[model samples]
Target: MPWSPALKSTLRSGLHLERTVTEPFQVLRGMLGVAIVLFGALALGETGLATSAALGAFIAGTASYQRSFRPRPVLALYAAAGLSASSFVGYLASPWPPLYVVVLGLWAFTAGLAWALGQTAGVVASTTVSVMLIVVTLPENVPEALEHAGVIALGGVVQATLAAIWPGRRWGARRDALADAYASLAHYARRLRHDPFASFDPDPLMNARRAAELTPAQARRRPSELAGMRSYAERIRPVLAAMADPRVGAAEEGPQRDRARELMGAAAEILDAIARSIRSGRPAPIAERTYRALTVPGSGPVLDGAGRQAALRLIGLLAEASDAVEAVDRGDPVHGEANAPGHLSRPGLRQLLPVLPHALRRHWNWSSPVLRHAVRVGVVAAVGEILGRSLPFQHGYWAPMTAVMVMRPDFSQTYARGVARLAGTVLGVVVATGIIRLTHPSAWICAGLAVVSIGGAYLLMRTGYAAMSTCITGYVVFLLAMGGEANTSTVEDRVLLTLLGGLLALIAYAVFPTWQTVRLPDRLAAYVEAGGRYSAAAVDAYAEPTEHSRALLRAALLEHRQTRAELLTASEQAAGEPVRHRGLHTAQLADARSAMAALGRTTMLMEAHLPPPQSSPVPGAAEFAEVLREQTAAAARAIRADEPVDLHALRDHYEQWAQWLPTPAADPADEPGGAADLVYRDAGLLVEALEGLDSALNS
Candidate 1:
């Protein structure tokens, strides 16, 4: 169809609006960075000040805004480190000579400390770069490089201060994030209600990601990083319990709709808590409490007699699961909280040692290997940079950037990184070379490009390590040209260096021979254990399970959901692991997801007919676990292809397990019939191990 005059006008209007939106932040940040560069030589961190200023201008948009001003202390600590290190370290090593190299151990020590302290990435980069730039490595042009570092550090400080002062600018974005995340949750819950069969869909992360992605605007709007809330899914059942069960929701409002409403409400509240904490810059105590509550059977009373029996029985099941989650959280080496409290008491090396008992620690997945890989990256980066400087290639030293990109978890990442490095370098070098070759742009132009590189730096961040390098290259190229290095030969050198950097990155990645396979199973098991502990808390509460147990469970569940996210990251990383481990990884992942669902389902059943806390043993609560454990044993045997589980053995264990909770009244007319018509559902998935080999297995 032919375009109409109206359409043309609309298109133009849209373009203008888009351009207007993009210009200010981008332009201002660039200008600020350039100004900082000019100032830092005199003032200590000119670039940092500029970068921080430019970043701070959009202060309203940080994750903290959602919390109503509460910031995550963890991230805050990092910013503090970043800001202080500039001043503290700058003073310590002044008049830093150009082309100097830091000792290997010092760089490793700094980088390792950051990783040890829980900064997995950006901080690690900062620390290594700090060592290379500030400690040992310096520029061919000392004055200019020092000027740049000072400006960068200055930009960072200004940005940090600005963000702390005003969070409202980013409040809307934070709010959007909460809204979108919940909206996705609601959609999924609704789907589950409509088609429980959808559980057969093996790839939940994909589904969740898809659901979130479909509403791009909403996903983008979430204020909390939430970091792949797989554990949070455990809480959904409790939220569902509050919604679906009459006692939890409006009693007279009717069960069908009220359950969903209450569940959605609880979820919203939790999300709100997250948002509120982020925006306010305060931690969400309620979020932590409510999340913990998710592990236990909800406090709703058991329904009419028969339903009540089922609910009571389920209570026992869920409580056992709660115990498992608790096991993971408290003193279990797997989750590492055991070492947290004792950190100050022990030697650092001892503290780093695995604290979980052997049995508990056996459930290892590669994801637990955070510290090791971080050290690897730091060591490699420092070593490669030192090597690069010594190389005969007087023109280009590309290894440091390569080391940064390749250092993460694996090698599958290397090729793309290589490509990105090469591409970004060439692009940046060309941009730098041309400007210097052509007529000079104003100081404004120079400053503006510098600032634009910051945004480009953030945008291209995950895209490639070379992106940051590119921006720096562009700035350097512009500086070179400004100094009249505009000759054809200079342009040739620029291209050559850029190419060499790309090549060097590839070499570093390859030489390291990293692989993608992440230790997913180990991570998955940790989540399972956490989930199990949460589940057991409900059961163990006996008659008077306190809110404390409930709170603990919720946190455990929350922790579990967080792992669900890492599981996905591991899946990507797993591409390089040996084939044998991959299957185990998959099984473990499946087990975790399944265990979470089963655990939640029990909580839901309990919510349907909650018994008073520990109102007597209520019959077969004792045997319930025997049944579940038996089932698990059976399943294990099945995996081994051992002799079949003995029918007699299975039946006996089932009977005992089946005996949990009070039995329903014989006559409907005599009492409220609790689930008499419903078929019995086991609270936990049962695995049947071969009875014949039981003795042999023990041996």
Candidate 2:
């Protein structure tokens, strides 16, 4: 009976079993949240209080899990759907049921039709499907359910609408998020200068990913607003690469760190300027001075001797890139309009048609899933009415829809959600029993429990598995008590129903398993394209002068970030895949990211020099800079991807471009749309990369 070594270690850890218990007030609040939503329906005008509570708890839980709600335009819209659905179900239950069914049914059918025909099919589908399920599961004439639904839906709509238009309407919200993104990047850069390699893991990538995922819609879209998030990513790629360099991290010398730190400080200024511009709704102009500074480049932070020169060159290139962004914002023609001359990489929506099948074919149940959920709702409501007909108990459709709502995207999530619900429901019943013992609780008690319930839901959400159950368990008890009587005595029924819902969700997640599935071949094809982009951008980074160098780096980072995101998505799709091994999928993710990171670093190092121009180009050489830019870009792609570049065609293009650069006759302003404005100096370095490729291969 004595403690074993492991047991001794655990006991010595000073952990107390009592710490696992929740506070009395906290427990009370959770019950209150459930009750308010159930009862609040009477006061809120439309969405039943119960509907209000459930949706509110769910959203609050979601926000906590995401850690932020910056990506709100759609999220808010989704909440609106949840509210409307829950409310409609309420109406369908009692005083006038057909109107509720009719309104909800029409809404779904129309939206579903629109989704089948629109660009934003995903958004519409997400809303419609959830709404339809809730409508079918609403509780019937459970005393004031309609009133509850109205109030709940109205409350949600108001909050979500405000959240959606917040930055545009809430004065400084946009500015705040932008400033935060920059500040975070600056802090990251400052830390990197000390030990670039020390933080070489994917933490930065993860952070950037999180920031992009969390930041609301306001930060990603303006010409001035980080260029739809692509530019902000572009600006950071070189920095991440530089830090990733083994040599950069290898440099323990004080001077080396100091120089990189200084360079980082300067780069932060550019980020800050961009942020300010976003706040002011002004064009993010790259001032002439900073534009001139980004010309130099180095593998690591700027060091002494050549390091200082590289830093200056980087500054120049950064400045020019910034200017180009500003130009785009100002509608300037130098960098072209929407098209980066020489190499037009326009969208190919037609190509997407072929890919759609790859995505849609994987759906769990292409048609029946939605219909099945609807039928379940109808049946549950009808049965509940019959069962409660002879009994004093009230019943409705919530039981069925509740089961549908809690179903997992896959078996894993479904298992966890189901377990949590059962646990939470049981706990809620205990709370209701306690309330009954305390004698008929008042509205204030219900409200108080509601708040507590919300807090618990928020905290538990991230814990997964047990979260939904923990919070919802308490919620059910509160809702039962809201019927003007301390129905808390009927806690057993609520718990049993929750148990029923969990079992149903498990059945759904396992039966047809559709949440995460994608075609392996298509995913592989996308990976090839992503790798190509990274390599191409790296090659472009070798261009001389500041302007082209920055552009290449920018392009490299954005492509890599996107690729990484896709790879992860693919991994999820491949989760529990019957035929594929999880390890191989994970390996694909690693290989893709490694190549991307390496390309980023090497490009930064190669473009370190910003030498003065050689002589002008030979006759017809004006276009050489661009064509060569594209060739290097293409070559880089050939290196990383399965798709080979047309080497001969690319070589001929560069050869012709070379002949056009130095011997320029036409005015650059009139030459062509979307061309790089490189002078004698910039064109000279690009030639090195072109010639280097030529010598390395074509020789």
Candidate 3:
């Protein structure tokens, strides 16, 4: 990928607007918080206080809109506290230029490192830096600075108060997340009708799982329908895959295959109904025809063997899902223990104190991308600030603020955001200046316009960085206008400073880039290791079927899914990067991806036939499992070191294990689709996948 084409593609992606569904009610709720702070302060004849508080309110509201499952009031309060602290520190350091620059660098570095916590934390922390830069210029003395900081904190209080008292659609995010999972399953079922071997995406289910994590208080009041449906949804997925797969469940071309397709279609309909019911908080009536399709007919050709087992399992899951929906309609209390499977737990805010240090330490190492990002941002921010102050611009903080907002951990986002921020600032400044000149709006009018702009920003938050950036620019312009800072020259200065800041951030990244291409080998190695663990766990379950083995298998499966998702994300981001490192090429990447997929699917097929607890143990299965784990772990280490993945020893071990296995009965009918036969067949498939992976890596 050449620089010219890569740059063009990144800019275009940055400028592209997403067709996001706007939530008018949520937007209105967020706007109301800003309105309370802005108008209330203005009514008291405190223009400066109004400006400070409005900044806090707007930023806190924006935090609420981030993709987080934490309580909205908690997010608002955290954002507020960070803003107030940053503003105080910035104002105190403003008297000494050198000290302030050093403090700014440290703060920016910490903000960049916050990415280790998650995107929501990283984004909100970065905004604190931007707010500090803007607000430090407001107060003249220590007392004034304290007063401004107090007001800013008050802004967050106001937002949090409103969110606590007037929460619209309580637990809405959870409902939507769970609904999305079932909806994804519905789509997967429909796709399986034609493409029986199609892969089911785990993203929605992962999101739903995150959403399901609840604090102690939330667990006490959770809705009954939300309690067990997610668990059932997770179980249903593998069963659907097993039913659709010819190797494990149905024959390729027979009545059993037809029955599998019919069951899948019915399952899709039922899943959609469940999704709608969960999302809308109302019971969706399942059609009689759909219900009848799940029943095994007495007079027609019936499914048998593995296909019948799959159908029975699917029917049972759907029935449980339907019961949950009915329970929601009845307003029943949630059943089962709080620590049940599929239900995740999150510590309360105070409980996080002991965990924060360890979390921070994880990303403090040189190998961490977060650490590198922190270093880059710290240097860039300090330099940008010095340059902004030296230049003949009235509001020099705009330069560093732009740089902080635009810089990200990856190349594509950093450059894309830089382009979007510059374009958005230009449009916002021009439009705002024109309106001020034509309308000659007063301070109060400006405050009102600022509120409207913030509402627009909230509504467009998901419509791409460019669209939201435009609204945010307008919001900032109007807020400043209330303090008598909206003039033609100000607009020109803002646009020019924005361009300069964007250039600084872009150039800094080019000089100190965190190329995803270089990290591709690491990501691939992680997936391979996770896949091996999953396959080993699945095989080990047959050696000693027990509650503990099943638990280990479940954990390994989750880790495998997470690693696969991470690899896919890294691949997508790396595709847009211009650098072509000596890692894996395009063809090798594709082959490796296919091999990993096959590895996971083969294990899943074997998992579908795992023997019942206390069943007779398969001979040499435990030894084979240990061998698989060790060989794959070695392969992963070799991959990370950019060495060839030699799996010949693993294949040799598999052959030895196969020879040690007990022979099946002479008649196939005696034990059709037996556990031993399935294990042997899938073990062979797993070895083939490892061989393919080795070939791809060695090539």
Instruction: State which candidate has the highest TM-score.
Output: 3
Judge candidate 1 against the unseen true structure and give its global Cα lDDT, from 0 to 1.
0.40
Question: Considering summed lDDT, which 10 consecutive residues are worst modelled in model 1?
Answer: 57-66
Which lDDT tens digits does candidate 2 get at residues 1-699?
A: 122442333232212112234334433433333344445553653333544445544442232123232433344445545555545554554354555444544444333233232223423333333443433344456444554444445444444444444323232443445445655555655566655643233334344343433222223232334334333433454444443243422245666655556566567667666556655656565455543334344463345433444454445555554564455466543322343222123223364477655544433254433333333333333333333333443332334434544442333344444555566556666765676557666655654565566566545543443554556545444544454434523555555555555555555444544433334333434543444454444444333324665566456555655655655665654553333432224444355444434433444443343222342223333244345445545654553453433435544655555554444424322321112223232333334333443333322
Q: Estimate candidate 3's RMSD in Å.
A: 1.9
Give TM-scores for every candidate, taking all chains together and pairing residue i with residue i: 0.59, 0.54, 0.97
Candidate 3 clashing pairs, residues 3+ apart or interchain: none
Question: What local lDDT does model 2 show for residue 348?
Answer: 33
Ranking by TM-score: 3, 1, 2
The residue-by-residue lDDT of candidate 3 on 1-699, one tens digit each, is: 778988998899889888894688889888999999999999998888888999999999888878899999999999999999999999999999999999999999999988988899999999999988989978889998998899898999888888889888888999999999999999999998898888778899989989999876787777777887898898898889878888667777778888889999999999999999999888999899998898878853356666667778789899988897888778676655677545688888788877778888988787777888889889888998998899998788888999999999999899899999888878887887778878989999999998888888889888888778888888888888888877635677888888888999999889988888888888988999999999999888988888789889999988998999988988888889998867679789889999888888788777766777887777777878888899889988998897878889988887777675577544323453454574556788889989999888888
lDDT of 3: 0.86
In angstroms, the error of model 3 at 14 is 0.9
Model 3, stretches more than 4 Å misplaced? 299-301, 335-337, 665-675
Candidate order by decreasing lDDT: 3, 2, 1
TM-score between candidate 1 and the true structure: 0.59
